[model samples]
Target: MIVAVWTISAGTVMPAAADADPPFDYLKVMRAEQMWKVADGSGITVAVVDSGFKEVPGVRSESVLPGVSVMSPPINDPDKKYPAHDDVEGHGTSMTAVIVGDGTGGAPKGLAPGAKVMPVRTSLGTTMAFAAGTEGAQGIRYAADNRAKIINLSWGDYYARDKIRDAVKYAQDKGALIFTTMGNDGDANNSGNLITMIPGVLGVGALDETGEPMELSSHGPDTDLSGYGGKARIRCRENSAWCVRNGGTSYATALTSAAAALVWSAHPDWTATQVARVLIQTAGGPVDGAKRNDWVGYGVARPSKVLVDRAGEPGAPDGDPLASPAPVKAPAPSQTAAAAAAPAKAAEAGLPWQWPALGAVVAVGLGLGFMVTVKRRRG
Candidate 1:
């Protein structure tokens, strides 16, 4: 696959060094504060597959597991380690803080403060590369084998490789939920190519404070969900007290991953499919469209709706929500009749008031299955 270089945008606004409380405007908008009171993602390990992760004072060291380097030529020199991982550019650290930072020393608190982070270092530079071409794939398999329930891939590329797809399938079969970013191509029509369009993995998009899709957020038929990606407040490098404003689908992906952790932690018995269903059913509000859109997929991720409101029912434990029947080579009358009869049943069932005008949506095989897709924008 032609993996794109994942770099933090220089356009990030660096706040003046101060001890004031970090503004968590995005958290407030998403009502994450309310959800945190119920479940802070305890016992959930989110594997952050990025450049590398930094262990900051605000983030408990125990919460961050020992990370591994998958870079070509094995860039694991101790001198090159930043907070014990080879993150020379600090992108992975920024993502780590958003997932598990404790908000000490005036830094922004992570959405899932109780969740643990597993750093799977894949590369050294801004762009990730593997000499053996299987390093990225191997890192994913490693994360799943180590008992990581959630895997966050905040980077993407244009090329799609069979090994990457197989790895994603392996992780999904192992009951691990994976999230990736849609490229930041800035196409208004939402016509951007993604590196991997696997059946089960989610492609996250970016949303601004106004509840509108970010201008730079990629969109397409594969976009499963959207999250807050505009100017998120994050802590600086490992031992630094400084804070900066970063924006991109990468941060959005991390935030979504944290939201998943919150829900999964609360309902440890639920399967990955169930957790994904709850998120989709409870996402967005009446102000947003009742039906899913191509830009924001199932609307913005609203974890509070699932954790606090306890809305939505997870249909099946093992069903593939994204699976649709392959286009028939020739439509038989019975198949056409079944398709025609679905809307009538759905209408009679009556969707909840929270999701107006969405009763027409149907699931192919499962009784109430709903497929979720995601995309991300580059920072």
Candidate 2:
């Protein structure tokens, strides 16, 4: 969550196959593209809350929505114009590129190209990430209210702020599937990340090229899941042909969001609970056959197992096995309004809470026992 200080050393890799999109080893390893033939996350909108965003060539500008900036005074790039992009420090764009980029001219192709992105720009890298928490809180709420169901929060702070927690609750109530990193301090501290303290927010780790947990990926009971962490391609500018290879839970989180988008788009009627359940069920579990481990939680995502192999069952529509009972604690009285008003608003129409319809056909004969009637409803 905390990108203490960022220096964009985006070393561009050489171009390959100008006529075709270059292959991303992570995608192939995860088999994420296997679902594109049937479902490519066409109707899902994932909100990426981070530094800023700019649509590069492989990342379609049309698919990127006109998102809002939550900066206190609002950043104005006098060099350009109003909202060419909220801000572009390269990090946010990189995360966005990993989830939805189309892989044009050797650029990175996101896992879910058919899905749209709603960028929520905040002052993440320019200042203390704690300060961005205030803006990120609002950004989360805004994204939830504006048709974004799959929300990605790639960064986090060390402390849990009440406003952000409340916003997370608000978004989850609106059926938002929130994803965040488990922090890069695994080898250093092994302490829990800010995301672990929040309920209904998934804390994701990363996996290496060998499909094992990444060495730097944080672990523990709070680690919800894992995703591909091998080198991923990213482009900083739109017109540039150069791309950089990067890896981390940030892209892992993005890939998880893209996986959710793929499942959600394929079964539009499924609730957040159903999509999440299937993802966890279909994921590649530990090699030892253990149910779950602190290192990879339930294991790395294998959405292909569901869409391609016709595996994993979507459970109850309303049941969320990962849903925490209640994590929100005391908040300053001044901030009671957002939390107080949430239930009232959440009660409004959101994710449909209906059970699957069941039907059966039966044929009945009269007392005379005359046969010759076919029951059309029979299956």
What TM-score does each of the candidates earn?
Answer: 0.75, 0.75
Highest-scoring model, TM-score: 1
Q: How accurate locally is residue 100 in candidate 2, as Cα lDDT from 0 to 100? A: 83
The per-model lDDT (C-alpha) reads 0.63, 0.63
Clashing pairs in 2: 1-155, 1-156
Clashes of each: 11, 2
User: CA RMSD for every model?
Assistant: 10.7, 18.5
The superposed Cα distance between candidate 1 and the true structure at residue 353, in angstroms, equals: 16
List model 1 lDDT by residue over 74-163, tens digit each: 255644533336466566777787888877755557889899888887663434353323555777888889889999887764343466
Give the residue spans of candidate 2 off by over 4 A: 1-24, 74-84, 235-242, 323-379
lDDT of 2 by residue, 6-115 (tens): 22222232433334333336666556656898799899999988877865566789878999877665346434332526554666777777778877755577888899
Q: Poorest 10 consecutive residues of model 2 by lDDT?
A: 353-362
lDDT of 2 at 59: 75
